[model samples]
Target: MTLYRDQALKALIPHVNDRDIVVAVYQSCFDWLQLNPRDLNYVAVGAMGQASSHGLGLALANPDRRVIVLDGDGSLLMNLGSLVTIANSGVTNLYHFLSANRVYEVNGAHPLPGADQVDFEGFAQSAGYAGSHSFTELDQFTEALPAILTAPGPQFVSMEVMPGDAYPRDYAYIHSAGAREKFRAALTRG
Candidate 1:
C-alpha cells in the first residue's frame, strides 16, 4: 500500500482552507502547488531544507491562519533542528507535512541513504510536537487528515510516498525574492 507523492498531496488538498498560508519547499511540492493554483497565499522557499523554519516563522507571525509546510524527507533531514524549534515555539496552527519518498525526487530520483531508517514521527514527538502521525496508504491518511488539520497542534505528519517525476523545467521560474514579495503582498491585501 505504498502511497505516491502526488496522491499524498492530493489527499491533503481537501483539508486545507483557502485562507491558509502555504509555505512549500523542494520541487515536487512547488510543481503540485503550481498545478493546483490555490487562491491561498504561498511562499516558495528555493533553498533546500528550509521550509519548516520558514513555515514556523510564518505561523508565528500569522497566528490566525493555518500554516501548511509542504516539505520533503531529504529536506527535513537536512535541518532536523528546525523540528526542535517548531516544537518549542508551540504554534497551534502549524501543520508540518513531510513527503517521505526516501529519495531526493527532484534530483533524478536519487536514493537517500538512511531515509527509511529514520522514524520521523517519533522524532517529532520526542521533539515535543503536540501531535504526530505517519501514513503509507492514502485511505488512512484521508480519513485522519481533517482531524489532524483541525486539531490544535504543531502537528507532524510523515507520509511515505513512491517517488514521482522530477519537477518540470519550464515551471521553475518562481524564486525566493519574488515568492516573498508575492506572499507578502497577499498578506498585506487582507
Candidate 2:
C-alpha cells in the first residue's frame, strides 16, 4: 500500500488530465488520490479490484477520457473476468494499477480462499491487456508508470506494495454529491 500509493502519486505527477476519471479500490488508493481529489476526477470503490471494471464502464461511456483503476491484488483476483471483458470489448482508455501486497490487508492479513497464490502481470496479459509489467523496485516503477498510462490503450501494471492499516474510518459511505455529479456528467458525454 505504501509503495503503490507513493509511486502512484509520483506517476500521476505528469499525466493527470483536468477531466479524466479515476476509480480506486476501496481503501487501496484514496489516501494517495485524495491528495488532490478535487483537482483530479476520482472515486473510491469499496468492492476491491472492481475498480478496473468500474473504470471500464466509465471508459466505455466516455471513451475520450482516461480512466485509471487503482486496484489491489486480492481484489483483482476476485474478479479476473473483468479483465477479459475489458479485452474483448475494445474500450482502450483504461489503465489498471494493481498492488501486490499479497494479503487481504483490511481483513487482518488472511490468506485468500485458494491458497492466495497468483501472478498479476501474467494474469493480466493472459486476460487480454495488451501489455503487462511488474515492478519490484520503486525507481523502475516510477519510470515505467507514465509511459504505460499515457500510451493510448488498455494496459496492466502491478507493483509490490507494503501493507498498511485500514483507513481510520470509511469514506466511500461519505461520497460527495457534487463530485459524483461531475464524474457522472463527464462519463455521460459518451
Candidate 3:
C-alpha cells in the first residue's frame, strides 16, 4: 500500500529535535512547515533538486548536529548525482528522505519519468551510502525511523507515498527573503 506523504512525514517528525537541521524542498516543504515549523528549518526555494546538496553542506559545516533533508522523487531526479556527492562527502549526520509519490505533485501532479522503475535505494547503496531503506507502509516506516536515524552516515530512505491534500502550498513563504533571513538568523544564533 502507498503511504500518504503527510503521514510519512508525521512519523519522522517525532524523531527530529531542535538541534537537528531540516532541509526541505517542493511539496515536502509545505507539509513539513505545517507539521513541524522550527527555526532550523531550511526551505529550499526555487532550487529544484538541491536540497540534498544543501543538507550536505550544512552537515559538513556543523558536524555536531544532524541534518535531515526532505526531498521529493521528482526533484531528486533533477540532480541524482547528489546521492554520490553526499555519500562521498563522508557526512554521517545527514539523512536524506525521498518522498517517492511517483509524480511531480507540485507541478499539478504530473507523472514522473521512470517513476515506477527507479530504484532510489539501490542508487544510494551503489553510490556508497552507509545505509539505505525503502518503505511503503506507515507502520514499517514509523517502526524503523528511530533505528534509521541512529544508524550511520549518508542514509537514504525512499518512502513510496501518495499526494496529500491536508496542507496548503505556501509558495510565497518558501520563496520569500524574509523566510531565508529567518533561517539565517536562526543558524547564526547558534
lDDT of 1 at 122: 93
The digit string of per-residue lDDT tens for model 3 on 1-190 reads 7688999998888899888999999989999999999889999877689998999999999998899999999899999999999999979999999999888888888999987799999999999999999999899999999999998778999999887666988988999998899999988888
The local distance difference test score of each candidate is 0.79, 0.70, 0.91
Clashes (N, CA, C under 3 Å) per candidate: 0, 1, 0
**Model 2 Cα shift for residue 38 (angstroms):** 2.4
Clashing pairs in 1: none
Model 3 CA lDDT for position 19 = 88
| lDDT digits (tens) for residues 24-107 of candidate 1 | 776655656655655454645556788899889889988998999988888888899999999999699999998887888777
Candidate 1's TM-score: 0.90
Error of 2 at 113 (Å): 4.4
Q: After superposition, how far is residue 164 of candidate 2 from its true place, in Å?
A: 6.1
> Which candidate's lDDT is highest?
3
Best by TM-score: 3
